[model samples]
Target: MRILVRVLKLLVFIMLINHLIACSWYAVGINDLEREDTWVKANDLKGKGTVYAYTTALHWSITQFTPASMEVVPMNELERSFTIVVIVSAMVIFSSFISTITNAMTQLRNLNSERNAELVKLRCFFSDHKVSASLVARISSCIHQSNKLTGSRVHSEGVSILELLPVSLKCDLAEEVFAPTLCAHPFILTWSEYYSRESKRLFLAARSSSLGAKHELFNTGQVAESMYFLSSGAMVYVRGDTRPARVSPGQWLAEPAFWIKWKHVGHASSTGKNCELVSLHCETAIRILSQDASTISGARRYAKTFAAYFDKQFDQLSDVWADVEVLQAMVSEAFIKHEKELLRHSVASRVVKDTKMPGLLRRMTSRFSGVSMASRLSSEEGMSQDEQINLILHERVRKYGVDGQKRREILGTRSMGSDSSDEVLAPVVSPVFRNPERRQSIGRGRFARNGLNVVPGIASAFRIMTR
Candidate 1:
């Protein structure tokens, strides 16, 4: 059908061109009418009178033989009418052709644009998909190996710890820590079985460093080849000799800017207290993370979540680390599984009476929910060393049990009251369970105390889970 339409259009265009050419030829022939009076006078025509009379009679007869009335019309008037009709017809045809061409061109442009956009979107989608798939595969492989190790009688707890530690740190502590924590997790068991036959092994170890020690700091101006996780003491983050901030045990350094070739923007120095640190090289970490697409995707997702949590906690910890009220608020709000439900139920009317609450609560609830969900997923799937460390610091406060809570209380109080030390260290507790029901109840109770209700989406998610 399309081909036939194109053929018809082409034929019409050719016919129009031929008609125009014929019109042009006729116009050239008519130009001689202007010079007719100059060549011969009307009175000096006695010899040609009879011939002229015959010629005029023949012309009249020919004109009278036409379909319409043969009244003699002025040549100029007839010519003018013919020219106007031809011009109007030509204009109509030209306009129709132009409009058709314009519409077709517009459709073609739109199609091309859509195709290009789809291509771009497809490329990005596939890239992410592939990464996600690879990560899953690597994790699966690691799990399989862990299972085999578990089958063996060797202590698997150490292997598990090794799997969690970064490559550089693993090499440093293989003899001391990695061999002991092999059976703690399934991942550990798998790793042990895989490396049991090998003579060389990897592990992580920490040693205390003297305060004000002139230890080499990773140059922030250069690309970070490794990341450091402080196990004990403190390290000062400096910008050219000026101490901007101090990182203590359980805190991590190094931004996840390696994917885009990012360099550190500042320098770090040891605060010289008895400090223990675990360092992981960047290339090894990338290689490990990139082994599977799923793992990478999982890590990336978790990274965004971790960053949010860190930023929030960092803000609260800026002046003092011992503010108990701040600590409770941070801990309680860390997971959004409950808070969202409170907000959802609170807003009953379809029409919003309070405009500010909706937007503000929605954002806050999303951040809380998103971060907690990301962390839970990351822990289940396993993550890179830096990510694991950050997760432990931010989410593992409960590991220390009563002691941990006491330490947190002290830090909170100190933060609210005094600045005795440049850096403060405390173990953050990880929540016992991520059950939606439990979270919802907690969130609702908190909201009731504050005189707010849960939002709809959060309420829905929670209600569905509870049922």
Candidate 2:
């Protein structure tokens, strides 16, 4: 991009110089109106339109400045002097343009060659060690990403970018870059929403690291010594008997460990792409929290609650994880499996006031009850069984005629109560001795909601075999 800009500036310079030369060429003859020997006057262009004069001047300017194959001859002494000056300027300007462009191209080629050499050596070195091709590719990706993020090549000997910055500058840089995010971190906020600049700085002092795919951050049951922050890329956290969960950017890993004595319940590793992680060690967190021990009442309570459920293993405890609480106050509303039943009952008992399709649970329960009591309701109403079945299976969940019956009311209420009770429903079957055609028709799904020619129910249709 820099090279392109340099070349563009040169092109503009050349065009501007050509424009000045063209104007000067046109002006020379006009300055001496009495002279008939000037190029413009000699060409009988004095009375000619400005177009003709400019065309003639531009012809000379373009040819001389661009150093085209065809050259314009000087016809008079002033023209000769002007030609000499133009020729000298063209030589210097064109020479510089050529030199600048050459240097830029050389630099670009050398940079590419250097990068290619490094990659070739990397691949060769990895291949020599019999590393899998896939892992080598991920390592290459890490190098490219590290170079991009740090704005320089990262060496293999374990030197880090943070070490390059002066101590005070590093603190200021970290404060500027990570202060807003770390300050509002859920765990940090649990300690206290507001902290001194120094307290925040200590959190921001967390160390950063770059890793390749499958680089393990922790082993199962390992002592949780640090909490990880995914700055970029993703990590997969694997807990026993559950699918791996992806930990995305701006999410914390092993957070509870940073606050209290805990061990990693699962393992975590970097994904296919490179990852940049910032880890706050337990010691660092302790030191930071110590500064405001009196204010960390909430954190202390949180640790106690977490310890109470020490054996419970969830997915990676990220901010975006399924059970994350956005607001600190929401911790009070959290419940265990046994507590969920009471909550469901409360929601079920809460009168549904919305006009739209009744509350989700209400609709589900009502639907279940309608189906169970479908055949029974048909017998009482002297209506065909098909009609009741259709009503139950119909997708338009709006309030309808049969849906308000007492049998439906009883069953629907039973469902809404979240009760597991002794109510059982009938199963469909062909009667003991019925018409074969009707039996075949019902067997062909003719009793389904979409069936156009409805099959008869137990009363009119078939000899449904039952004990």
Worst window of 10 by summed lDDT in candidate 2: 329-338
Q: Could you give candidate 1's per-residue lDDT for residues 1-467 as a string of tens digits?
A: 34346647865775656445344423432445554331122223235665653443334323322233333232454444654554565566556766676776677678669867865785577677775777656554544443333233333243455477666555545535433432322222322332332211423322222222434466555655555556556777765455577776655666333222234556677653334455545455444433223211222322323223322233221211233343343333222222323234333432222465544333333333335545665666556433433343344333434344443453332221122331221221211111222244434421111123332211121101000
- Model 2, 408-465: lDDT tens digits are 2322222211223311112324312211123445354233212234544322221111
Q: How many backbone collisions does model 1 have?
A: 60
Question: Model 2: how far is 86 from its true place, Å?
Answer: 8.4
**Among all candidates shown, the one with the greatest TM-score:** 2
Regions of candidate 1 where Cα sits further than 4 Å from its true position: 1-212, 240-243, 257-260, 295-297, 303-467
Q: Distance (Å) between predicted and true CA of 352, model 1?
A: 44
Displacement of residue 315 (Cα, Å) in model 2 is 8.8
lDDT value, residue 282 of candidate 2: 68
- Candidate 2: the clashing residue pairs are 430-464, 430-465, 431-463, 431-464, 431-465, 432-463
